[model samples]
Target: MSNVIIIGSGAGGGAAAWRLTSKGLKVQILEAGPSFDPLTDYKQDNSDWETPFPVKEGSQGGYIVAPLQPLTEETQDIRSWSFMNGKYVPGAFRTSFGYHHVRGFGGSSLHFTGEAHRLNPKSMSLQSDYGVGADWPFKYEDLEYYWRIAEKISGVCGPSTEQRSPKNDRVLGTPHPISYASQALAAGARKLGLTVTENSLAVNSTPQDDRADCNYCGGCLRGCQRGDKGSIDVTYLRRAMQTGNLTVTSSTEVLKIITNANRITGVLAAVDGVLKVIEADLVILSAGSIFSPQILLNSESVHSPEGLCNDSDQVGKNLMETLLATSTALHPDKLGSHRGLPVDWISWDFNDPISIPNVIGGCRFSPSMAESDVVGPIAYATRIVDGWGKDHKRNMQEAFGRILSISGIGESLPNSKTFVDLASETNSHGLPLPRINSYIDEMATDRLRFMMTTCRNILAAAGCAAPIEEFSSIDAFSSTHIFGTCRMGNVTEECVVNSYGQSFRWPNLYIADASVFPSSGGGESPGLTVQALAIRSADHILRNKGVQ
Candidate 1:
């Protein structure tokens, strides 16, 4: 029997394994996708330039996304925002959803842009501060220590304390210089009296832990070929293996969790291709917000008619996704916006709810060019140019190295309209595919509108004649940071886990992923926090069961 069984090898699971194995606990990880070796698999140095990155979601990388719901079309609608007689107006933009996530040894971090962010201290108290989303059980100060630890291991590069980001003040490593496009955006933001701060990225700016620094290749989303980008595979999982107490099983899809009375006994999974039950003393669900709850819901038995660890029937409730809006403009100069890091600069001037008067939550925008893949001439032809042949070629040439994009990340308040559940159909693995339904409430829409307008203003401030606004309040199914399916709170009936990510319903069964986040903090990337929570959960386990 394994000492501990973690059902994923992503950010949360990797960190949990690192801490537990370092402390002398035998750990096993079952992942649904194959792992990759950066040296051979990345191939960024030799890849053909014609190939577009971020291959269709779930189509490649063994990551399957749930079918889009409620609203299915990808076309821009009026409900979000549109030009009415050359004036921007809100139209009937229905929210079509597409989850962009990679399921592999390192999970979504394999393709993530590596922006390691922490929640704004005030954002941790959404219920107390803004009355929109629920408040976290603990304060930012409680998690700061863990954030620092995650950053150190991940080799995060950022501004110093004196030049700290609004979200985290204790950043360690130094950040790279802003891209030319970002420099323009910064100048524009400063003109508007907004402070554009350096981004805290989980990329090595200097050699650390034997990994090379970033070469500014601008292929972050395609998976970093160089060991510089701090994906969990190279950071936490590598450390866990160094302890020699961790075993990672790839291409093992979970079927259901087996429980004996009030505690988890093991997990039934398809190991490679064979179905088997792996026994364990403890089980940690790190399969992300979607699959984690789906596993619980599929674990229904005579004892748990609904599901294990789901007495509150909140297994798949309160599914919150990333709320986003962005704009792009054509610059006069070939700023070479694609060479450096994707989003080197961000602004938090309007990151406070109080700063926006009636706005209940906050939002942030960044100068995103390379990270968005708005760089290559091919990208210009496909994304910016509308025609074909000669005209298109000329337009592409005109737009190359001249595109500037500003994107906003905002908090999506948990609403009854948005959630996930079991669908009637099954996936290729025969498990019932999770059904996700998402909505954008008026309050959330207000935030999206603010972000849209703000991005456009920044572009204009940067001396661009026209900044095309793209409002995704009801479109652009960017589930970049999913959360709150199995929420954590104080009340047992109202929560799925405790402050330390221990499940309330089942003993020795814990969740250390985005599934346990009570609320989606304001525009913060969830990776670092996921690691911190998992580490904390492992420590809680150590406190109860003894490490050795």
Candidate 2:
């Protein structure tokens, strides 16, 4: 038996493995996705991007490729609950949400674009800031030192002078030089009075922790072959294994939690279709926001008939997907090369106080990295909603590489009404899967509206053509930075976990994923926070010699 068994190897799990293993505790990481070695297993084929098997119905959109597989399957149509006309109603629409996540080792961070931002200060006090969401157990100041630990562990890089100018801020290293395209966008943003700064990335611009520097090839999305992106596989996971106290089981699916007397004794899992049981003194659930809560809901033990740690009935609530909108423009003047990370430059002025308070929600602006095929003098960028065909190619040639984009990231409030619960449906294993019922709330909607208006003005001033903006009212979706399900609070009556990520119902059970978030921050990417919180959780466990 291991001293600790961690479910999921994404942001939180990876961090906890390193923290606990370094403290000489036995740690076993059970990952449903296969182990991927960037050096040998790098594949560009559809299999590398495809979703795993055991496809379930009501998945609406064909399941998105889990991080493990990299292929697209036949798409599907589905419906979701919508908050319209001041009421919750059912609507018909479809999306490829699952496509954004990955299953294999390292979790979704393996494919993330590496935008690292801290949570908005106001986000910590949601009750005071907006009066709509709940307050966090801790504050931004509470996690400052841990944030630094996370940044160093992840090898993050950004502008030193600018990023560290704030008193509450602490950065790890300097940023990579800007590409020609990023420089141009920064100038244009300055011209429009928007604050454009270096993008805070969880990638190494220079060698750190025995890793190499970024080569400026801009292959972040497809994958970073150079091991410079600082994904978990290259960072914490590497060090955790070095401690010789970590055991990683890849391609092993966690079926459910086995609990007795409101405490977890072990977990039942499937490895290559073979069911097995693993017992541990402590269990930390870091299986991303969607799957973590889903596992709890599926595991209905005698002590927790509603599912483990779900006595509050807030297992999967307050879901938040980053509010994203892209605006494109053709400059007709080629700015520079586009062969680098997609998000080299970013703007933070979307949090401007002038109109942010009254907007339906809030928005954070960032510089859009240039795309390779869309960067020449004769080019303009356009998003083709329809399938790409000959006509699309023709349009592409007309505006091949001249388009520049500006984007906004907004926060979603914690709404008990928007949640995921066990559905009447079950998977092939006969486990009750989760049914997500949610949509963009008013705060998110208001933020998107403001972003559209601001993007248009920024483009006009940047000497580009009018902007093309996409807005979603009821069916909006984004792939990056999904969080919140098993939220943390000071009391068990309201939250599933405590501030240290210990389960309210089980002393030996913990969670260290995005699900522990009380509310998603407005501007900061959850990656840094997730890592920091994981470290903090491990520190708490070690100090107390495990949760009481």
Candidate 3:
């Protein structure tokens, strides 16, 4: 059995672990953060959900190699976001790098909203079809088979009747009832000649995989306490461990990838502050877009001084920080926005560049007030209701369940200005943090404006008052769905990894994360695709090993 060492425990790493372990490979997962017990460590009931947010990311057991931000919760603070300055424009793009980066055995999956998505065909072929973005090395059809496998493993829920391109033919479970705000948002979208469908969520509607059906009490932003949400910890990692072929070591930050003679030898890591080099027959990197390339850059040596697998000088280039926007207004009636899954409904009407008017890439929208507020009185006292004594209490009561917010995610083509590089500052481990320099060009900026306007209109049509620009999600670099850096392609000269996620220079090194994406899909979540690609990579490794 091949001894595989996988970095990260997010969607890609988890899927890879499960698939490789099931194939009888000896897999060891090294996570930078401590593993959490879904039954215990989750803070669904915590008022300050974002306390351990980006500010103190590395102060814990482990930390992501990202652009370090100040130890403050303003990144997710709705109050800090722009109120539109009484105009339609967003307050301001975020400057701090505050992603939904939860470091642990489950990685960001532990705190994600569980929106599983596949890249639309046009999105995959952005460069071929449109003049914007890099096209995928392979077609979407090639990945469809693995999409099915990933959805089944994730217990993703969606209705078969919804005929969205790249969606699963057989979902593991049914979708939950549309959230209260989504009900109105859907109607408003149809009025604007857009199609709305239930989101393909990796959350339970009916019990499956011995997990509870979603109670839909909201507060998902704090992370799912119950096992209903298909976090990597509860799903893939759990199942992988059950196979007895996978060994998971949390709080073990991979410092550098040690190599020799064009082959991966092992990873230099700090296992709970103790440094050691653990050998492996193969290494799979799934440390998301930021850290994956960061680790590669940090592994500089005489053999591969420009960084391993970066002979093409494309390791940390072509970074595409995820683009997102939110517009919110008070609904005429109490929609109970706090209850139910936060974003149960989504629309892919503009998931292709052709569908968008004067837009370069793809985009999608959904109701997100529930996700923004993160449940009951927490967001109100801290973010929304902004007063001192009795007035604050009254405003809190008024805004409690009457919020209607619309969120949009748009695709941005890789540009030269935006990229991942080593920061001048070093961390406690003396390793430099990955400095994320994000830039959205005029076309992407225009696309971004379009998303905000659409969201504002949706709220207005949905019977909400003039929607205020809730947040631009750009403060620092608050990217939740970042992509690219170690992009995959057919040409070894232009890409870091091959079509099968194998590094072009290193035979035994593979990558299975959003970093390999040629282009971000029309605002689709990368969770499903990340898992699918990892599963496919595992199969490729198996095939390379001559295992049928």
User: Evaluated with lDDT, which candidate comes out highest?
Assistant: 3
Worst 10 residues of 2 by lDDT: 75-84
Error (Å) of candidate 3 at residue 317 is 0.6
**What is the alpha-carbon lDDT of model 3 when measured against the actual structure?**
0.79
Per-candidate clashes come to 5, 29, 8
Residue 209 displacement in candidate 2 (angstroms): 1.6
Quote the lDDT for 177 in model 1: 80
Clashes of 1: 5
Q: Which scores greater on TM-score, model 1 or model 3?
A: 1
For candidate 1, give the lDDT.
0.78
What's model 1's lDDT at 535? 92
Model 3, range 221-276, lDDT digits (tens) per residue?
Answer: 56787788888888999899999999888878898999997799999999888999
TM-score of 1: 0.92
State how far residue 444 of model 3 sits from its true place (Å): 1.0
Candidate 3, after superposition: displacement of residue 430 in Å? 2.4
Ranking by TM-score: 1, 3, 2
**RMSD versus native structure for model 2:** 7.0
List candidate 2 segments past 4 Å from native: 39-99, 161-171, 352-355, 369-398, 468-474, 546-548
